[model samples]
Target chain A: MAQQVIIKVDNLVKKFGNFTANDNLTFEVFKGEIFGFLGANGAGKTTALRILCGLSSPTSGQVEVAGFDVYKQTNKIKMNIGYMSQKFSLYEDLTVRENIRFFAGIYGLSRKIIRERTDELLNKLNIEELGDKLISSLPLGWKQKLSFSIAIFHRPQIVFLDEPTGGVDPITRRQFWDMIYDASNDGITVFVTTHYMDEAEYCNRVSIMVDGRIEALDTPETLKKTYNAKNMNEVFLMLARK
Target chain B: MDNPAISIENIIKSYDKVVALDDISFEVDKGELFGLIGPDGAGKTSLFRILTTLLIQDSGNAIVEGFNVVKDYKKLRTIIGYMPGRFSLYPDLTVEENLRFFATIFNTTIEDNYDLIKTIYRQIEPFKKRLAGNLSGGMKQKLALSCALIHKPEVLFLDEPTTGVDAVSRKEFWEMLKELQKKDITILVSTPYMDEASMCDRVALIQNGRILEVETPEEIVKLYPHSLWAVISSDMYKLESDLQSFEKSVSVYRFGDSIHLSVKDDDIYGSDIKEYLESKNQNKIKVEKIDANIEDCFMALMNNNDL
Candidate 1:
């Protein structure tokens, strides 16, 4: 079976005045695949991600997300994708249930479906009892998990997570990856950016951006073999140092 | 035989009804690189503040360089270098100005302690004219460490130094820490990354305001009580869910591209898991015995503590 290309970019160029943030980048993310967008600080990864998420317009070239053109059909593209940022954007004063309802409502989910899914999500994450608890009282891991469940509550075709597990413990990080894998298994493509190189291994394919360009793009196995590196950390250093 | 570089006994801290540190106790030997390993809100910052005399503990005692954290704080302040988690340097000041300002505050000249920070300072020296805010993440870290060491303190306390830095920069920063360790400076560093735990001479795994275990990285990994197996399949996500249903599977969690399964010693075999997943029509099934790391030990401890 041929996997469909869910995200397509060809010579995508994004510039901020004299500087090129994403310089003629080209890549394809297949359906249901965990595609890792990796880069160091000031490497233009966030710019490229924002452009893909329909939050920013590119300077030139072709870009498509979820079968919608980024330039003209941004609204349609936004309707079919979910985005979770590095910062925990949940309301601190609101209860967990209230936060879920607020986000779900904004996403245009039906009230009945929202109620059903909210219950299901709470049960799945083993936090059903904490639904009435204020978000500020939750631990960092619980808040992260809750935020992730809320992001995908509408069941978007693609999800964008930027450093979703930063400052989390290893065990919690593993669990978060499990959540990502579960989403991938459900036929939803995952587009994630992270600073942890070890996480690059979890992706089916990864594209490393260096100095506003895609320096390497391949499966973790092939990249490690091609670079003759023991792990993704070494692979990242090899390219980033250049 | 000499007193440890830093010592804490039954230190407790709380904010309102939330207990941040409960009966925490630890010691750092002279010239040792120690790590406080845990997730966020694990009381690392609270503990660092107490040791540096920036915050008072609710109960118990902490001593740095033979001075009580509470009573002798005035004297203790001069003997320790502290870099907080947040970038607290003067953003408006140039890199050199910040370094010089910090040196003057400690009543010393950058030239007098130039040898102590020569290695780290050289990295950021080129950016001396740049404002601290305009420098890159890695460069800012270098500048901050330079300022912290300007006074040549007897010990260093770094709270999550590499929290938001890039992986390449993180590796470089750890290397610089190794260089600093060579100077025989007692260092206590806290980070959430388990991989960094192995770099320290010893680490204390803390969670929910309590220390789970304190030992060398190698020894902590050796504490993983059960044998571990790496399991992979064509559909790893489904495989993980299916494996969790198996009664014999003690604990299963994702590790990189594969799932690590912990089983009773000499009880569960690789062949048994392969047959089970194969019977369920999971393709490309591979299960093999593997060695555990500090992360595995931490998970085991967390699980046990939760139960």
Candidate 2:
């Protein structure tokens, strides 16, 4: 049995002026795998993520997302992937139901499908009563959970989550990871970036970026054993310090 | 007894209908590294604001360096340094300009207090001419700390200083904080990172504007009342759901490669869990009784509070 590679990047280089933001990165994300993108601040994680999300083009290299070429099929790539960041997830003024409907519509879902999915999503989250309430009024944890649900609402082949659980409670954070696992179980490839080391350990495999380069990419257990470190935090400190 | 660096006596703060801080009280001794750990909307920022004299509490009182927060706010301001959760430095100003501006406002020259911020300032010296807004996240944080320390206050308050910072930079920032504490400056820092709590001499685990426990990290970890077990199997997700359905499971949380399960009964052995999961056809199951860390203690406290 062969694993399906949903995102393929080979010698990917992204430069901004003279600075190489992503330097010769190569990695493949398989279907239904939770890929953890770990990096220090200013380590090109954002640049690579932007490139993968089709918001920016790569400087050089072969890149494919959802079977679409990065250079020529950016729109198709965007259509096939979902993105949610902690900074921008949902419209604050819009009601929960409205935010869901708007994003579903943007994803080109039909009116009938959007209507049905909205109810299903609200009920699944057990927030059916709060559907009419504005997103701004919801708690941070609730908003974050709802944002994640909406991000995968269109059923994109891959969902990019950027620090999706930042500043949430421990229980809520674990619940959020459980949701990620559920998404992976449902066959959506999860590509995420987080500063929390524990969250990094939750990934099926993790790639640590250093100075705009992929310094290490492997399962957390292997990485920990290879580095002789107790946990991902020590592994990160060891690699990042170097 | 000698005067504690900072003291809060039943400090209560609210806005309209929202109670930001509910009779919060704590004390930090002089030259101690104290951490206020909690999630966002935990009223950390509100408490910081009140102590820094930026906002007034609706009731109760706070004292910093023996100066009343309300009555002697002016005096308190002159002796305390505050780095807000958000970047409050002038974004348009150059790094050097911002540091110098902060120095001037404190009735001191850059040269007069250069030694106080020497270590932090030296790192940002190359970027002295760069606009504060243009610096990277890590560099911006370094610059902010430099500016905060330019006045060399006896007490420092850092609100979520490492919130969005990466692991490497966060380690470096804590090193800087440790360096600062050596100078006999009382430091009060807040962060959502549970791992960082161990670095502090003592920590106050706060949630919902109320303090859950204030003790050394070791003491806090010792407070976890349940025996924890780490369980892993072929199916990670199913392992979590299955553990949740277990009759004796009190709480089941996904922790990295394994599920940390707390049984309702303490005497439940690892073999018992293994047998149950094996019955469910979970392969390669590994179960071990493990000690709790700060995060586990925090989760237990949070759950108990909810109940």
Candidate 3:
């Protein structure tokens, strides 16, 4: 029924000593759907993303990722998901194809699939000529798209992309999301965080965070309608100022 | 003292074997607010650094306020104000102290040029006693900008000045730049945001260390080659792949929830493209011929260049 709720997070509270980063947070991301988790910088988006990725543990409250309890089954969750962070997460010294191979190996992908996928990804990006080129040699736009493709190459059940399009051109960012859509269509759940308001409008459902808690959670249209706003920027402004 | 603000001819800059700028030639009219619109590593920073005498170009020449970047760097340094992309204020120094330090570097006092930066300085006046690093991002932007304007340089160089700040801060920062331009100062700012390109009097879209197109934002958008459509459906991914199968598909680029398609012919309408989508299992498809903005033109130009 409804894919049995692939991710269920309940009142997840994460604090750094006296400072509360994620306060009384609760959310659920169903399987086979794009769930966007968005927030301003220092609003606890990264804190929550780190917790969900099993990179860090919540200070309190129940949490689960891909049916694995974050407290006890972090490695299992890691295997079921892929993460592309805001920072350039790939090795600069590695070639485009080599980065793909390295990330694939970390996820226990076979050599044959890695080879096939690397070629396919390179071809899809229309940059197969640059496959052997150093990652540093490519433009930031190309590097971001390549890093995005490599992150989800292992075909995990869920992929977490944090600000995947920051600092890229509109064309490159456009193409990057196309590949994201291709993956989600193949039944991979996308749990992404972004500061780009335009990108948030693409999600099936999005939760806007403010002051360590969800201020809004709904489809773009629903949030827009509820707040009597014309664009996502206004809706965010209304919520942030409130 | 009497030059057309800035002028460049066949400017080429490289870092060792890597070419950062390739035969770039552009000029900023006297008191004009010119913009360099491109992504990271697009050489906007390199060009700014060269114009400000911070980095020397490999070849060609540039003149800023009658001073050359290579031959008259010391003279150029005294006449140009530069605010770098990153916030480069001293963490330990207070806002007032930082301002004073920059004033001292230019052989001037804050009191001498306080009138020039009065409007911007007022915003950070309350936090003047606070450590530069302790201020918020928006506040730090104001402080950095105020310090740059402390000496009242004849030409201003701002490199990616609004990145990482909120939309509100970006808007506010641009407003401040416009006010600065009105004081008979030549302003040159570089940014990655396509939307910000319109705020300038003219912009140059650069890529791969090459200048793609240089024109006003409205003129660039007006010259877009093809008719555009924003198509959306239930199965968005398939819509992208299937749109390629249609005869009208020239190029498909994902834009938020919709796929913006550029077609070959004007007579081949969206209705015809809709029928093709129906055959591909995408329902409730909406399509229309819409206006192409600056970003669309940037991509179209990029596509044309690639071909």
Candidate 4:
């Protein structure tokens, strides 16, 4: 069976004044695939992510997200995608249920559907009792897991996660990855960037960016074999050091 | 015998009703690279603040380089270098300006301490004219470390130095730390990365402001008391659920593409569990015994603590 492509970019270039942030990037993300975007700091991953999320326009390229043109249909693209980062996600001052309702409303979900989904989500996360509690009272691990759940609550076509599991416990980190697996199983295309190499192994495909260009893209096993490396970390060091 | 580099005796701290550090006690030998490993909100920052003389504990005391943290705080401040978790350098100042500012604060000159920070300073010297805020994440870290080392201190404290850094840069940062250790500086660094624990001479696994265990990484891994098996099948998610339901399974965790299954019985064989998973419609099942690493040990220790 032929795979369905959800994100298609050709010669995508993002430049700021004299410096190029993203240099002639081209990649395709298939529907329901977990795509890992790996790179060192200042490697243009953020620039490319901003362009794909419809938050910023590309300097030049043919870019389409969820079948909408980057330049012509940015609003449509934004409506079809969800974004969550470690730096920002939920409102700390609001209760769990309130945060859900607020985000659902922003997505233009109907009140009837929002009420039903809120209950379902709270129960599914086993936080039914904590629904009335403020987000600040929750632990870091719980907050992270809840943030991820809320990011996908509106059921967008693709979810972009930025360092979703940065400093969580080892056990909680794995549990969070389990949630990613569940999302992918439900046909939500996951485009994620993380510093942890072990998380890279969980992705169906990974692309490593270096100095504003895509250095390598393949499955973890193949990348390791190609670089004669023992793991993703070693492969990253080898390519990034060059 | 030489005195320990840093010592904490029953240090207790709290905020209102919440306790940040509960009876935390530990000692670090002189000229050793020690690691404090834990996740965020695990009281790693609170402990660092107390040891660095930034915050006073509610009870108990700490000593660094034979000077009491409370009584000798002024003297202690002059002899210790601390790189906080957040970037505390002046963002508006150029790299060289920030370095010189810190040097002046310590009553020293950049030339007088030139030998101490030479290795780290040389890397950022080319970009000395760049604003501290404009540097990349990796370069910013190098500049921060350089500022921290501007004055030759007996003990160095680094709080989550490699938290948000990429793998490649993280490796390079550790290499720099190793070089600094060779100069007979007692270094105490904290990180949430379990893999970096092995690089330290000894590590303290802390959670909820309480130390879980303190020992060499090798000894800590040896403390894991279970038969661990790495299991992989065509369907990883299903394999994890099936393993969780297995009668002999003690714990099941997803590690990358495979699931690390800990069994209650050491005598359990691979085929025995493979047969059970196969009956549940799992295909391409491969199971092999493997040794526990630092993360595996961390999980095991955390679970035990909760019980």
Candidate 5:
């Protein structure tokens, strides 16, 4: 039952001129684990995630995503991961099935498998009848689900979800997590960044970044106990206030 | 009838084919902090707009501070502060400029209302020179709140003020609201975060233009009609599917890392569910009886309303 470390960061640092966004950050993300990266508005979580995601380069130190070097193997790293942001990234003009096919094609998924997976995904979400419907016509919850399904369509080794459940209601948020669990169960690592305390509690392990450093990292239970807080919100407040 | 700080009598509003507020009615007593809790497109913002005299309802009466929203809107405008869901401050204006502008518009000086918005204003004081657009999310919200309070309104209406805000600022914002509540101002706030429901004195759960329930957080939780249990195992998604296989299960949904199950039979104990998960060959199984919170109650209500 030994877990493999898919993401490895060692003393990673990112600076913007005189400002240090991420300072000496180090962490290990195991395979298929839902690792939460939590922080306040100005915290360096986004910087660290971007480095891991190959979108932004680190100033110094070592970072590897899916065993690919962040600096030298950015293309390889990009291929092994999927990314979704809070801002709905789907094409509003494209139909649901068309969007799926487009993303699948970009990932170089075979046409036969893309057709099969597209049908299966629509069926699983119980939105088969709406496959031809434009993305803009869908509700917020449905759009979120569709975006998530599309993100994992190619079955990347790891998926990066940046505040995936933001603005959705509690029920929709829960259903979104179910989709996350489904992806994780299929051996896809989930690297999520969120401001929602309740969503942080869902992760197997979470790292809290404050003022360009990893303030705390552990299971939700352990972090609660260590900080002597009732919930993640209290834990975040306690750290942020300091 | 008892001169409630704010009262709505069977309000209904619509746009084209969409019913934004469907026969909704509620009351907020003086000095009370009432929350209008619901998701996006659930009529919360529409209700707030009507209450603040910014939008006209198709039917029903809404009164704020004993002044009818539609008839006494001119006077009501002077006595109520409204912080819309979107940040409405001028992006080009500095923090102080926005506050001063809002105060002068109400025919008052910032010094006259200095004590009212002191706490929120101080948070953004250092950034007074910065443009509202350039300020951070938390700072932007603080500035918005300060501007809203500069007029010293009798009642405050905030529509999703904390949305898109980080956890630290959200906690800070709620703390500020608690301080404002002590000033004897009747406050009506709306948010999509259900965890915040418990912070309000009372909340009206709205969805799809209808009021699902209105009660104190504890009272609403007590209304959860079934025994709930928190169930978890090494394999979570599989555990959810396994729990769904139990015919006695009324509802099973994920809450954080654990699955919250509301069984049909109240007599079904936590141990019974644990035993079943064990039979499914799930290891590290943990099941404990737990109380339902506002989010759970809201989901149940939403489902029932859908049916």
Candidate 6:
């Protein structure tokens, strides 16, 4: 059961000069679980994600991903985890197939595996016909879906998605979560941050951060019951009010 | 003088042979809060742009408040307020400065009509000195609303005004719109959030540049056309897959923690669906007949439009 705790944090603190972005945050993500990190805009959700993904440093406390210290094992963590950001973090000038080739190349996938997986992902996403189209031409939803697929192309143990469906419609959002479900089914842990309350209900467990502190964390059902609310939005409102 | 607020007869718009609006025709009732409800690229923006005299239609005619959109573009501009999907406030200017600039552009001032925006402006009054770019998303949204209302135009056009905004802010924004509606300013707003459909006086469900149905929110929800159910069960993936496999599943759409299922016929009983899930080893299966909401009506209209 020791392997179940794929990620653990204790009193994790991150500060940028005088501002403490993340304060004494503690949480644990289980194996094969979809974890949701939620908060308002500028609520320090992004700050905590940056620390976990090794994009920045924490001023104090401890963080361990896949049982490795984030400070000492940053490179190993990068190799073992995938991170999809809020922005479309791909080359807009490149073609669909070329974008996949570039990222898979960096992860050092074998040529045969890259070619096979790239084709499979494109087909599954129903964007095979637009494989030659520039990333700039595709709609917002398609760009987000492709960015997510590219993030996890290397088969990382833990994949973090930061507001993966920010401006997309509900139907496109359903499609994006379907891919996320597919990933988690393959034993990959999904850690996603979103401001959308309905999307928050999609997670196996959720933690709400407010004012640089984690205010609530539990399964969606439990959180709803505990807060005496009907949905995640009400629950967030309840906690934010406090 | 033409008396209608806006008029369009079989207006078609295309970009390089790609049809965006196809023979779409609609009219804005005087002093009516009209809503164009659909997802992204559903021609909501295109329609608003056309009605506001920004883009000319290809084959038909459209007029705003009796001014031909194609012929009297300048006359239409002074009478219609437009708030785009993205915030268009000058980022370099402060909240008050931005409001002042827009008012001046329309040949008015904050002192001229401060009462029109008093409700919304009070919320942002403390931040009047802060640049528009430095404000929060919700604050920027309020500022935009105030600037648009500063001129007190006859018609207001908002394209997905609530997108990217928090729930509280969205609720607040709609309240402000409703308050403004009492003053008889015809409001035409477009949004992708199906839940927001109920807030409007009358809504036109548009998809693929075509109007599916037009009705009041209550009337639309009342005419849901079929019975719906909200099913909650364990092993959600298995339950979802099983529901999809079931022949009775019209459309198993997810709504929060429950999967909302619709049936082809209105008379189908809910107990049968509950029992079917029970036989599939799905625990905690609870399927009860529920009332159809605006979202349900919108989906039904969309599905019907497909046919």
lDDT of 5 by residue, A94-116 (tens): 99989998999988899999999
Tens digits of lDDT, candidate 1, A1-242 = 88899999999999988999999999999999999999998899989989999999999999999999999999998889988875856999999999999999998988999899989988888878999999999999888888888888889999999999998887788878878988998999999988888899999999999999999999998999999998888899999986
Sort by TM-score, best first.
4, 2, 1, 5, 6, 3
lDDT of model 6, residue A17: 86
lDDT of each residue in B135-253, candidate 3, tens digit only: 87778888888888899998889988877655555667898989998998889998878888889999888877888888888888878787789898987767878987787678887
lDDT of 4 by residue, B79-128 (tens): 99999999999999999999999999999999998998898889889999
Residue A6 displacement (Å), model 6: 3.0
Evaluated against the true structure, the overall lDDT of model 5 is 0.89
Residue A160 in candidate 6, Cα distance off native in Å: 2.3
Quantify all predictions' global Cα lDDT against the true fold.
0.90, 0.91, 0.84, 0.92, 0.89, 0.85
Clashes of each: 0, 0, 0, 0, 0, 1
lDDT string, candidate 6, B76-118, tens digits: 8999899988889999999989999999999999998898999
Worst 10 residues of 6 chain B by lDDT: B298-307
**DockQ of each model against the real complex?**
0.70, 0.80, 0.44, 0.83, 0.65, 0.47
TM-score of each candidate?
A: 0.94, 0.97, 0.88, 0.98, 0.92, 0.92
lDDT for each residue of candidate 5 in B1-307, tens digit (9 for 90 to 100): 3588998999999988778889998889999999988888788888889989889999999999989999999999999999999888999988889999999999999999899988889878988899898997788888888888998899999999988778777877899999999998989999988888988999999888999999999899988988889987988768888999987887888876588998876888778888888888999998899999998899889889221
- CAPRI-wise, candidate 3 is acceptable
Instruction: Give the lDDT of residue A24 in candidate 5.
Output: 97
Candidate 6 regions exceeding 4 Å error are A1-3, A16-18, A67-74, A89-93, A126-128, A136-141, B1-4, B305-307
Between candidates 3 and 6, the DockQ winner: 6
The C-alpha RMSD in Å for every predicted model, in order, reads 2.2, 1.6, 3.2, 1.4, 2.5, 2.7
Model 4 scores a TM of 0.98
Chain B TM-score (each prediction, in order) = 0.97, 0.97, 0.94, 0.97, 0.97, 0.93
Residue A178 miss distance in model 6 (angstroms):
1.9
Q: Would you list the rank order by DockQ, best first?
A: 4, 2, 1, 5, 6, 3
Per-residue C-alpha lDDT of model 2 across residues B1-307, encoded as one tens digit per residue? 7889998999988888788899998899999999999999899999999999999999998999999999999999999999998998999999989998999999988899888888888988998999999998888888888888888899999999999889888988999999999998999999999989999999999998899899999888876777789998988868888998889988898776678998766888999999999988899999999988888888988887321
TM-score of chain B of 2: 0.97
Best by lDDT: 4
* Candidate 1, position A118, lDDT: 84
